[model samples]
Target: MSNETNAILNQVIVLLNRSLAAYLADAVPWMGRAGAEVGESLTAMVKDQQQSADRLAEFVLDNGGDVAAGEFPMSFTALHDLSIEFCLKKLLQTQQEAVQYLQQAVAALERAPLAKALVEETLGSARGHLETLNELLAAVH
Candidate 1:
């Protein structure tokens, strides 16, 4: 993998980790029973993101690149002052941003079939998340 490819993979890993943490921190608290269900769904999504990160890390290692470690640098204000509709919209936006990043990573990994497939799979999952979020937002409105 080229340095550019490695950097892109690392950025995706960081973004995935950061987004997982952010969703857990910001979105989970406002949910009730529905929130619990959503939390469970988010947990599964986090696991998927982790698996993607692990695959990217493996690719970095195979290419003799150092895997990025430590915190992924997530920060978000709580949705305390916001309406449920607003919060859901913001969460949907975050999911869309993640999908965009994964798509970019997939495009960058065109030469690496396995890595590209892994990223594409994760991108598909993110799109599913966006669909669910859209449904939730519609319900809130």
Candidate 2:
């Protein structure tokens, strides 16, 4: 992979760890009115993000690239007595952004066949997550 490709992939790792997955995980316990079932689903989404990052990181390492390790997104670190409606809204918004970012990453990774495939898979997952998040948001009262 070229330097540009490596950099983009690393950024994606950071996003998954610090933003997408971290946001959901942090908000799960505070899901006012969303209930245990939504929390469970959010937990699963967090795990999926981690697993996808692992796959990307492994590929990067095998190619002599450093994985981007980072803390949770700044927004996630802030305290808030978040409602289920607000949580779902934020999750859906971020999930939508992640999907767009992944689409760009997939396009950028064309020459890096393995990375492209991995990113494509991630993109697919993100799209699925986006749908679920939308449904969750719609159901919120």
Candidate 3:
């Protein structure tokens, strides 16, 4: 593979790591709470995001790149454990991070058609999750 290809793969892997970290960080307490279907849904969404990241890693390997290792560290490690209500708000922040990650994937894929197709597939799921979050937010408000 070319240096350019390697760089793009690295960037995509970093973004995938970021997405995984965001979900794991956000979902732990959110999913742990009772009476919070939204939180539960968020957990499921995060799981899907993790699978997407794994698929991307597979693509990276298929293209002759090394799969990135380790989980993303929590950026919100300072926050106290939150209630179901507040966790929804936290999830909104997480969803934003997810959006940014998907956008980065879209940008990275622009230079690699096969990667582009993979990212486009991921993008569809991201968009659906965004819509689900939007509906949840709207209902809560």
Candidate 4:
């Protein structure tokens, strides 16, 4: 791959990692752990999402792309500090950010044949996260 392509992929990895950390931090203390069975399920969902993020990071690194280590979008912090109930809203916001990031990442990958497969694989999970978050939010609202 060209140097430009590699650099962009590295940036995308970093962005994904940042999004993952923010969302995971926001969703701590699952609803179940807070004495609500529903919270437990949410907690499980968070864990799964975390795993997916890890996998994406790993994939990026495997391709010689470093995960982006940076601050989440400014909007994530306050909600990250809130309780699980309030945090569910933050999770929805996070998924929205992930979708946006993934879209850009995929667009970048479109030029790098070597990096395309990894980004495509990650795209599937990112899209799934968006769908799941939307469904959960619908139920909550």
Give the root-mean-square deviation of each candidate in angstroms. 2.8, 1.7, 3.3, 3.8
Give the C-alpha lDDT of model 3.
0.64
Q: Note the Cα lDDT for every prediction shown.
A: 0.71, 0.79, 0.64, 0.60
- Expressed as tens digits, the lDDT of each residue in 1-141 for candidate 3 is 555655655655566555533544454544343446665566677677678778877877777778666555566554435554555665566667766766776786676787777777777877787777777766666
lDDT of 2 by residue, 49-109 (tens): 8899899999889888888797776676452456656667777888889999999999988
Give residue 23's error in model 1 in angstroms: 4.5
Model 4: residue 32 alpha-carbon error in angstroms: 7.2
- The list of candidate 2 runs beyond 4 A from truth reads 27-29
lDDT of 1: 0.71
Which model, 2 or 4, shows the larger TM-score? 2
Pairs with backbone N, CA or C atoms under 3 Å apart (clashes), candidate 2: none
Model 4 lDDT per residue over 1-141, tens place: 456666766665555556633455454534434435435545555565556557656766676665656566666645544556566666666667766776787787786765677666666776776776666556655
* lDDT ranking of the models: 2, 1, 3, 4
In model 2, where is the ten-residue run with the lowest total lDDT? 76-85
For candidate 4, report its TM-score.
Answer: 0.65
Over 1-141, each residue of candidate 1 has an lDDT whose tens digit, in order, gives 777777777787777777743455444455643666556666776787788788879878988887776463334545544444556677788888888878878888889786688778778878887888788767655
TM-score of each: 0.78, 0.90, 0.72, 0.65
